[model samples]
Target: MLSNQSEVPSLGPIQREQAWDQLQKNEFDMVVIGGGVVGAGTALDAATRGLKVALVEARDYASGTSSRSSKMFHGGLRYLEQFEFGLVREALHERELSLTRLAPHLVKPLRFLFPITHHLWERPYIAAGIFLYDRMGGAKSVPAQKHYTRAGALRLAPGLKRDSLVGGIQYYDTVVDDARHTMTVARTAAHYGAVVRTSTQVVGFLREADRVSGVRVRDVEDGRTAEVRAQVVVNATGVWTDEIQALSRVRGRFRVRSSKGVHIVVPRDRIVSDAAIILRTEKSVLFVIPWGSHWIIGTTDTDWNLDLGHPAATKADIDYILGHVNTVLVTPLTHEDIEGVYAGLRPLLAGESDETSKLSREHAVARVAPGLVAIAGGKYTTYRVMGQDAVDLAVDDIATRVASSVTERVPLVGADGYFALVNQTVSLGEQYGLHSYRIRHLLDRYGSLIGDVLSFADGTPELLAPITDAPSYLQVEAVYAAAAEGALHLDDILARRTRIAIEYAHRGVNCAEQVAALVAPILGWDAATADREVANYCARVAAEIESQQQPDDEAADALRAAAPESRPELLEPVPVSTPVQT
Candidate 1:
């Protein structure tokens, strides 16, 4: 139940190679499809319980909904309005555990102000909800909500329109770096003994008379096919749930619909706020969350049936968010203030509601076939519960008595000695020749493993300095990304590993080549391969920019699709097997 932070799963070249070898060699107890948060969490859960597990992803880790979230480990305050007490309570419990034990390095308490539009009824109504939220979940790790008068609220957030609010209520929630957290979860699973592979696509399902046997997948990196046999197969492919179900040819108990949510990032100075803001919108809700040096305002939920991989944010989508947020802001933001934009799709279980936003956020799990257990629909906050449910059901089908879930007690790698490492920042700064502030940043980002990144600068002192193009990060970060983190491609390093892709003004073009060069030796990339990687990444940025200018879905989809994929072999579509009743 304890994770040794010093010892990582080490998904470097040799480790990934060994993972494939193990995949082909053993008939695992469980084969988990998808590498999103839920899939990664499921792998950790099963492996910790002594099950032999293998997890496969068609793309990089957290390339889907897992990374594209609003970044809050909130209990969904709005869910109280919908009378979803159970969901909110469960999420609050998980949020508390994540903050205090599981991932203190990644998830930290964040304060938010709920601006009151109406004077009397709104304050009392919101207060009641906040009161219930603080006490539920069987614990409270954050501060309770506090009331603020209009003057007090203005002092906290001066950018808001004077007439926008009569008062405010401040409460706390946890914020996270979604992609890094997902990767750490998968790495923790690897530490506990799970064979995890990215760039591995499941083309078909292996079947036996009335049950699922295993999966047949292809390594997108090289043209290699692998037959991985397992006692149980878990379908956790997020938005592509039904697609995976079709491969098994079994009638699914439910269907999944794609709901696209888009977010835009702007400079921190644009919105003068000491805390994050949550406001009510026409259809759903609007959040102005605090991201390090930037402020993220977004999330318009609407039906999306476009290219699943790159969900493009149209001009209209951007305008819609601007229009709503502009209502409460004194200084109306135009397109000029925006720095970056990202879009992600949420998989909602098909229901009676015509509105995608109104569809249930609760998840459902069922045995689609004797050995195939499928789970769909849920928010990021409840992924652990969803994962636990999937593994528990798979255990039921295996018909073997095993230990119940104990992930609550397992701290992720880097979380064990985080507080002590934070305390050592001053000394660490003196030793590494970095400023105390810089040392604190690295400590929070890497926790106990900060030493691993610092070690890259041992011989080459130049690596200790910040990256010239992206001064926020060290050159050693890019080098260590390839050598330590499981970053194989240039896009993997820029986009997910460090978030340089969305955080920079040039969309990573300025630093893409430099980062590639830094990682070239570790990845064994030749001159030709490194150049190709940079070109592909630049093209992707250009296409994304052009797509954002388009007014509608079809135009944007075409431009986005025209961009080169990071892996050339992935450009070719794989054929799905015809449905045959076993």
Candidate 2:
């Protein structure tokens, strides 16, 4: 079935205002309190179930942990060592679902080389685990694991030191633009009649006797307050789960601890490999995943307790990753080779183990109280399962029978007709006066809705040109970000809507003015407001760059947290009690 560009809902500024009005005038069956991947999935699930649902976010969509992921959708291969078979299987199942039916456009197959350092028992032991992994997920869309000799492995990856491994095994996984995927999920929910609004903070709970009746939300943009009534409220805030629960005046069933993960982005030429590389770290596995024109390497699993909003990556974090990755590379990478850095927190359910890496990735759902539900913990690959579980518990609070989850069958907004669009790339390029490669890039990002993005440049043909400072992106993307993708500020465009902030070495500083100007008219920003947006984005980039130079988390966080908030009211204290007047 073809997906008409007009059929996809536009979460533009007008729709955002309409959503806020709907929240005030109509009561909902469910109100979701976060806009991350899990929360977006939950909203999609509830909407597809024919539930009256509304979603609110304090910041832009995927501004937290959801966007900073390793950008992979796969069964955690390392989890096999921990014997968390069920977790791996469930994640693999979701990965297949995304690859085949749900989000074929966003999730694509990627190969990784797992280098073997020991020859004795290592190859066979690792081979057995991979064999099980390949079989566990049922039907396979990617190729099976392939064994390679030391010479063959080196042929695939000549950048690796010859002495680093005796042999290698290459397996398949998937990668995505995490922030874009999360936002698209939320957009899909919006298309199906769910109310999704960003920059709206849930300040306090509306209580009726002992049950949570609704929430009091503040517009972080203008400081305007409104009360939204719902039969049930769901808290899917990742690391801030406890903070949101406290507003209900009830103790949570399980505590969530924050585990910080960091990643660095360097040019793809730095690592000369046909397939992505996966190396073993002392705490966890490190993945050098291939990105367009770049390679993303990361993820230090460590405990973080300082600031939940802005988790900082210290200089030590970079040095640690470089130290381990350098051990295998023939041409080692220095700090100057790094292009970008990011840090995100994992909302792990606190367990008996003191080590963050030892904590379980399994999720938990609880009826915190009558008319309220909370879901936390889980890998990014299994977000759909987490959403389904959370909604199943929440249906018990509803007055009527709700339909089972249809999300497994429901493809995201842009998934349908994507393959057909791929076959027409050359024709599309000719029609749009662009190259086939640029057309394919748009198709990959927007799928059947590529026209929606291209339409922005209809009257203004200049919008079709590449961004000045960040040439990888088109100028129209910045315009589409504000016009239909719900980007309210310059930071949203630079950081999430487009990945210019992380993909470029200047970290979006040099192009701040151009992007701000491109988006100003769409966002209704005056010259002064546009200038403020550019300045704020520049300061944010400066702070992040400085923070990455700090020696430790404490110092890094202080530097990052001191940077200006695009939405200033997010820093305001959430009221403990519902207002008597509202």
Candidate 3:
């Protein structure tokens, strides 16, 4: 069956205002603060369960830690070493659900080869662990983990150092476009009649007697402050959980410590591997994840006590990741091989006196107050479970009885016909006059909603041209971001919607103007506004680059903090200059 080509449902201005008005009219069943994956998931869960829900985020959706991650949807392999069997099983189940049932289009299976250097004992031990991993909690979607000899392992990952491996084990996990998936979750919530708005900050909580009744929010987009009332208020703000708690004037039962993790992206050709590589490092595990035409290698987990908004990767952090990764490389990746760098803070429950690596990846939900519930400290894979738990707690205060969460059976917007579309990809590609690979990419990102994106190209074929700087992305995507994906700024389009910043060699500097120009008309930006958008994006990228060069968090945060504020007025119309007559 052909997919519906109607505008993919989103939060419109009327609906947003209606939600704000409803908060004044009557109390809602739930009000979720923070538009990260967890928050979005909570909103979806609550809304799907027949709760009157409203989700508010201080910045853009997933602007913080959610957007900046290792971009994997796997049960933590490292958690196995800590003997956290339950957490890994739960996360692995969720990973399978996302890949097969909920969001098959966004989440897909990825294979990783873990090379063993310690000969006999390591291979069997690791293989046994992977064998158990495959059998545990809904791992049936992908093939079982396979043990490989040195020669066999080299065939999958030729880039591994010849001397580094005695053997290897190939295992499967899943990866996602984190920012897009998070946004899609919020959109799905909107589709289910939840009021979702970004650039709207919950500045303070509205309390009744001793309970949180609602929140006082400031719309950063228009600079208007208003109150939103709900029977229950959920804090799903990840690293900012404590800050949200402080807003409610309630001391949280636990503290969340921010552990900064950084990742570097390079061209796919830099690493000659058909399968992703997982290498054990001195500090933590290193993953060379395959991402489209590029490879994402990352994650240095270090204590971060500086700025929470833009966590920067210091020179030391970069050196640490490179230092670990270089040890296992056939041809070492140097500074020149680095295309882009991004750092994110993991919200770990505080109480440990040990290193950040020792902190638990487990999540916690606490009823800190009568009407307030806070959920924090989990990896991205288990966000759905985290959201469900938070809502389950908040439901206690819900006046009228509501049905239990049906989100488990409720497929995300794109998952409905994703498998069928995948099966018929070749025919669809022929119909669109595009390559089957490109069609597959579109289907994976948009699923049944690919028709909406293709509709734009149908009217204006020029939109089908690939971006000048970031050739992997189409110009149609930038246009779609503004017109359909709720991208209000150039940063939203380039950084989150398209990932040009992390994939491009110049870090989206060259394409900023071109992208701004494409999105200008859709977002109502004039030449001056377009220029300002380009300038802000460029300055932000420059600041991030500068920040990464610093030695420590303090220096890095200070350098990165120099980024210009998001000013919509800068996108206002410019006066036309009069032409000179010769």
Cα lDDT, all candidates: 0.87, 0.91, 0.84
User: What ordering of candidates by TM-score runs from best to worst?
Assistant: 2, 1, 3
- Clash count, predicted structure 2: 0
lDDT of 1 by residue, 1-582 (tens): 244666776778878888889889999999999999999999999988888899999888999898888988878888888998998999999999899999999998888999999967999999999889888852387789999999999999999999999999999987898988998899899989999988888887898877789999888888698899998999998888877877778778888899999999998999999999999998889999988898888898989887888888889999999999999999999998988888889999887488998898999998878889999898898888998999999996665566899898988888988999888889989998999999887877787889888988888999988878888889998888788778889888888888777777887899988898888988999999999999999999999888989999889889998998886656333223446454
> Candidate 2: where is the Cα deviation over 4 Å?
1-5, 572-582
Per-candidate TM-score against the hidden true structure: 0.97, 0.98, 0.94
TM-score, candidate number 3: 0.94
lDDT of 3 by residue, 1-582 (tens): 112325446443445556567656666889999899999999999988888898988777788899999999998887888899999999998998888899999998998898889966898888878877887853588888788889998888888888889888888888899999999999888778788877778877888898889888877767778888889999898888776776677777888999999999988898888898888877788888999989998898889877787889888988888888888788888878889899999999988757899988899999998998999998899888998999999989998988887888877887787889899999998898878988898988888888878877877888888899888888888888777766778888888988989998789999999999887887778998888888888999999998888888889898887788674321211111223111
- Model 1: CA > 4 A from native: 1-3, 571-582
Error of 2 at 517 (Å): 0.6
Give a tens-digit lDDT track for model 2, residues 470-503: 9989999999999888889888888898999899
Quote the positional error of residue 261 for candidate 1 in Å.
0.6
